[model samples]
Target: MTASPALRPSAFTDAELIGSGRRVAEIEAQALQSLARRVDGSFAAACRLILASHGRVVCTGMGKSGHVARKIAATLASTGTPAFYVHPGEAGHGDLGMITDKDVVLALSYSGESDEVLMLLPVFKRQGNAIVAVTGRAQSTLAREADVHLDVSVEVEACPLDLAPTSSTTASLAMGDALAVALLEARGFTADDFARSHPAGSLGRRLLLHITDVMHAGEDVPQVSEEATVSEALVEMSRKRLGMTAVVDAQGRLSGLFTDGDLRRMLDDTVLDLRNTRIGTLMTRNPKTIDARQLATEAARLMETHKISGLIVVDEERRPVGALNIHDLLRARVV
Candidate 1:
């Protein structure tokens, strides 16, 4: 329990500073490894208890453990588990009414003797709710009273004085993440399912945004008939401002695509006439296209894979139903 040496600005060295950081990381990594090995049948029991519960998980803790509990609750909620954090202090002050008989209480206390957390256990027991406790002490009150106990003990703290809850807190959080991932897998949660809960996040834009959501549709899509000239296709491209024009046949099915890059390359032929030359003769046929129902992220992938900057959203019959470019994806924040 010796105190850490005081770090004065003048006494600091780059190697010593970096070494301290590395030591902390090393200690926390070792603690997490220990935690992984100890996740046994009790872990399964805890997951089962949570899964069987009809209501949300009520996570309660005190101080630092409370912060971890809040994060755990958020992770669980976003990963398809119904859960929320309830401060033990607040629960003692009437917040306990939020918990129902169908809910499961996940209590966190590193020492397994937090008075605030312990105080609520009797109430939960009387309410006929299951208790899942996370603690560092195996023989403590919180552990003894619980239906399931997850041991998150670490040999020493990263703090030189061995007093701060550094390694122990890291272990607790890692354990919480482990539980969340296990529950997520058990429920067969998918990325799309996660995106539903995080619609405002970047992942949501990538997964939940369909090509139709961001594509230019109806007359907004740049298009011209195959019988049209290269000059006429350029008019459609300019008027629609899509940097490309889909050259479709009389049936409104895509025949080819003409882009700004085609216009640049067409300049290589000095004798080519934009007024008389047919757009179909200069257009790129069998170009990369996407389905309107596909994820917008898939469109970005298609563009990046082909080193192209635009895509045409086509229907099953290869008809141009919509049009979009990298800029459109950028606007939608899908790129």
Candidate 2:
């Protein structure tokens, strides 16, 4: 006889499901809290070993632990500690050559007895590299052989089956994060250093992009003499399409600036003799300016705060060197 259709489990009420999730969250939080309390001299020792290493930290593990190792290596590398992930299985074949006397090895195993990981100890030792073991069992061979042993033991797995790694992996990842932050703080790593490492990132663009890099130079910069007529200055502004023109003296030093706003005020006041009116008479003299070497973001902030759309880039002697507008900043991604 054929079996009847299997009955689905009874649906849980929303309240009951919420309570179950809350309990799991509380239990996992407590587990992490307990793990934090266990950190002591061993954690410090591991940091010291990694900090002293002249070469990159080579991280290794198997299966689930292997995923955690890759993340830990990336975190370390991004936070001033040079590190790379090397699969233990691959290391046993030929990748062991990546480990050098100047490097430190971090091996992870939840059971503390992964055969593939264990096979790498002899090669690491022979290469004269220091080992830091992250495992749940302090008495395990991997932990016992390590120069510094970090205990990542958890009271229980979050998995209901008690087979898949859950709380244990969380503890290991948190511990790895802690190690990376501690090393970063101890090294006094600065934002500029981080920007150098991540030049293509947003922070790098904000901190490293200079005004000279994006400003228009030479003839592209709108300029007129102090004696030039208002009509001539207006023509120059239109030709350059910069919305303003720098007014300079015979010595080439900036005397003033005539902008679209100034022209509007002049026309509103019924100044009809544009050909007879000198640009210096209608210009804003000695306007706020910036050095060519200043960061583009700083210039953007200055413009934003002053409610201006453009700025004249100047040299040490206040001579017009370059010019930039809001469009330049937007194109450079400094806005």
Candidate 3:
């Protein structure tokens, strides 16, 4: 007989479902709080072992622990500690050759008895490599065999049946972050160091992109001689579409800036004649400028602070070399 499409007998109510989620979060939070207190001398020893190693940290684990191991490896590498993940299940199938004697092994196993991980311990021992184990069972075989063991044991699981690895995995991840952060502090890692590794992200663009990289150079920069009439400056600004034009002297040195705002104020004077007035007469003198080598994000800040939408790139001698507007920064995703 076919079954009816009615609700299951034990389905949860809306309030009960939300309460279960809340319980899980509270349990995981408490687990992390406990894990923090357990980060003792062994944690320091783990950092020491990794810092002393000349080779990369080879992190390994099975199942869910493997996921956390991979993330930890990435964090360490991004924070100036060279590291990578080597899955234990694949290690037995010839991936073990990827690890060298100089490298340190950071293994994660909540039970501390993952057969795939434990199986590789003898090989690491034979190579004389240091092993850092993060496990819940302090007296488990893998923990006992490791050079240093970090305890991430939690008294309870967030799962209703207490069989899933909810709290245990959370504790393990927290321990991994603790290790990465400690190593980061010890190595004196900087944002530039981090940006070099994360060059594809928004943070990298903010740190690595400079004014020269985004500014329009050469003939592309809208500018006119200071002696040029306002009508001529308008032609240059219209041709470049930068909403502004620079006023430079005969030597090509920036004398002042004339933008759409200045044009508006000039037009407010009913007697003023655009055809007869020189751009220098209506220009904003010594307008805000930036060095080409300065960060693009700095330009965003300068424009925001001055309530302007554009800036002129200048050399050491105050010559207008290039120009940029909020549109350029927007196109580059710096804004």
Summarize candidate 3's per-residue lDDT along 267-313 as a digit string, tens digits.
78756777888888889998999999999999999999999989999
lDDT tens digits by residue: candidate 2, 132-249:
9999999999999999999999998877677889889988988899999999999998777777777886788997889989899999999999999998998999999989999999
The 10-residue segment with the lowest total lDDT in model 1: 1-10
What would you estimate as the lDDT of candidate 1? 0.92
TM-score of each: 0.94, 0.78, 0.88
lDDT of each: 0.92, 0.90, 0.92
Clashing pairs in 2: none
lDDT, candidate 2, at 25:
75
- Select the stronger candidate by TM-score from 1 and 3: 1
> Which of candidates 2 and 3 is the stronger one according to lDDT?
3
Instruction: Go through the candidates in order and give the clash count of each.
Output: 0, 0, 0
